[model samples]
Target: MNAPQVSPIGGLPSRGFAEPHQNKQQAAPKNDALVQIRCSKAAAKEVKRAAVEAEMTISEFMLVCFHAYMKR
Candidate 1:
């Protein structure tokens, strides 16, 4: 006889879990705005590397930098 695989959080099988957020139309809040930035290839690569080092998404890192600039 084979035993069923269970989820780490509960006895329910992993496949039984429902991810409601996945079905949502929008991931971010309505008040949040989007901004686009264009940079040279070298600058883009440096930003990606810095974001990784800071353990943040590229967007998060950019927001942090922007806020710091605004405060100065």
Candidate 2:
């Protein structure tokens, strides 16, 4: 007996075996809402640093923080 091959991406089955969802189009959601924050130059720099440390974009970092706040 022989084992099937796998794709490096998504750990999905390869060799003509594809899931239905995998074939569907995936798009980024539209940004319909906006929130603005004002801060000093130092504060802005700190936010940038923190976002980088967390390996997320500035927008992602902000959303994560906002979600955490809402959960509390």
Question: Which residue runs of candidate 2 sit more than 4 Å off their true CA positions?
Answer: 1-34, 68-72
Score every model by TM-score: 0.36, 0.38
lDDT for 31 (candidate 2): 73
Candidate 2, overall lDDT?
Answer: 0.74
Q: Which tens-of-lDDT digit does each residue in 1-72 have in candidate 2?
A: 999975578675555855667435465466787655567999879878878888997678878878865676
Local lDDT at 24 for model 2: 54
